[model samples]
Target: MTDLIACTRAEFARLRRWPAFWIILGTWIVLNLVFAYLFNYLAYATGSSMRMSNGQPRAILLQQMLPAAVPEVFTQGMAMFGGALMLVLGALVTGSGYGWGTWKTVFTQGPSRARVAGGTVLALAVVVVALVLTAFVVDTGVAAIIGTVQHQSLALPGAGRSLLGILTGAVILGMWTLAGAVIGVLARGPALAVGLGLVWVLVVENLLRGVASIFAPIRAITDHLPGTAAGSLAGAMRTISGEPTPGVLDILSRPASFVVLAVYIVVFAVAMMWLLHRRDMA
Candidate 1:
């Protein structure tokens, strides 16, 4: 435990100086801000122009971008960008040890293979949590400002529920981060890990989900994919903001989604540990 803590501190210190960490984090914040602005604009524009079936002006803007709706905005933004950013950062942090030829040096410093691997995972988890919290705070502040300018009520509603959603979304992203750590170890390079992880997330998982929708047999298996499970976990946040639950593709119940996410985290952690123990640093 002492060795693990020491190694974790070293990892954190290294992360403090990592330019990629700040770059990815900065990009995540900026992109989400842009999306928040666009979402508000669309809601306001539609409300100003459209009417309900009863011929009343639609309150689409208030409905979607009210201060009370800030949590929903944050949730959606994290669902879209948080997982991907976590994957990239995870890869960069773990794979860089090899890319910089520091893996062997770290091993020579007296920590067992498991201690080093465990410490790295622990450090990445801390970073993921911090990033998630930062997103919530920044997005909520941006939405509040926008709502104030639009003359909407600035009171946050359902604060408890919104917080629950944020935490759940964070956990899902944390799981993705660990999975990326495994990919980093396997690929042994940041560039390759990021490329492979993105392809898996943006291409393969998406394609599988789409195919699952059209083919009954494929649907059965695709529902069990790690990406689908993560989506299910993140999608649950929508219900807190009174949005419709995600459809057939998720298949798993909320409880089941949590279980699946836990399973994935455990499997990835075990795989990473096994590889670290069995493989040579060089």
Candidate 2:
């Protein structure tokens, strides 16, 4: 137990010291801010136009941005900003484990292989959870400020649903971070693992969806892809025209995709442990 705690402490300290961590966090914040600003502008413009048509007050403009602010925001924002950013995040978490000969030092700490891997997984999970939640909170707060300043009613009808979406979306992204860690440890070299991890999120997963589109039944297969599955958590849908639409309650209500996400985490964690056991630390 002491060793495990020590490992966790060390992992946490190492991550904090890395420049990549700050870079990824900075990018995530900037992307969200940009989306929030654009959406707010579009919402105000459309709402003002619609209100004039109906002789309603200009305050209706705030409502236009409401959808973008709520359940849809986190998922859409993450899907847009998170793809590359998440890969960068995943890379840093996993990369530090193996990059710069850090893995050797971790293993040499005299803890058993299981303890070492378990500690790393725990540490990564904690960090991912904190990051995703913090990002969502920031998004929500920013939108609230926008609505408030614009004199928009803070009481959007579906605020609870939107909040739930933000949370679930964060968890989904968090799961991917865990999976990335496992892949990183298994691949051993920080650079190769980080490269493959990025490819998995940005290319392979997306390409699978594209291929699935041409085949009729295969389109449903996107429900299994990491990105698509995770998107479901945020209640996001892609139109047949390849446009994004807000997902319905039916999509978000189902819990199966989250289960699959957990499976990914567990399987990779096990794989990481198995690989750690086989490798010689010295």
Candidate 3:
């Protein structure tokens, strides 16, 4: 336990200084801020000249940008854009170690192979939590600003609901991060793993989803996909707020979404550990 803690700390220390990690994180924050607030605000500002995307009136659009909508804004982008960026971060953090020989050096002579993998994953978990909380805070600030400017009430989302939203974001993002870690270990390089991960997240699953709509039977399998599960979890939060937010789905019940995401995270973590512990580093 002590050794694992030490390993996690070491990994976190290194990741904090990693420019790539910051770049990925920064990108997500900016994307979340823009998509959740900027676009909505712009649409609201356009007034009667433009149609509201969700068919809600301009007033509803403004309400969506108020502080009380923080929980919704916190998770609105997570299913698609946030998850993709996180996968990139995880892939680069783990797979890049191979290209730089960090994994080889550490696994070959430094510590137990399991220990190193555990530490890296534990560290990545921290990154996942950091990303979620950062988004929440930033969205809250922006929403508060908009609320004040528009003279709306600054009331916040319910505490319990907000906590649940945070947990949902962590679960959804955690699954993707671990999936990227496994892919990194599998490909043994950052570029290939990131390419494959992005394709699966951004291209492949989306195409399958379109096909599934045409072939009802395909919906069964697509319903269980990682992206689907992640999107469902985010949608669950939206359900509480009374509408499906952008880039999410309301296909699965909340419990089922949590179960599916938990299963994927475990499978990915186990696969990554097995590959690291048993495969040849050469």
Best-fitting candidate, measured by TM-score?
A: 3
Write the candidate numbers in order of decreasing TM-score.
3, 1, 2
lDDT, candidate 3, equals: 0.85
**Candidate 3 per-residue C-alpha lDDT over 194-227 given as tens digits, one digit per residue, 9 for 90 to 100:** 9999999989998998999999989999999999
Q: lDDT winner among the candidates? A: 3
**Selected candidate, larger lDDT, 2 vs 3:** 3
The deviation in Å at residue 135 for candidate 2 is 2.0
Model 1 per-residue lDDT tens digits across residues 154-214:
7875869677766776777788788888898899889999999988877888788788778
User: Which whole-number lDDT from 0 to 100 does residue 19 have in model 2?
Assistant: 85
The parts of candidate 2 lying over 4 Å away from their true place are 42-61, 64-69, 156-163, 216-222, 236-253
TM-score of each: 0.87, 0.77, 0.94
> Quick one: ranking by lDDT, best first?
3, 1, 2
Q: TM-score of predicted model 1?
A: 0.87
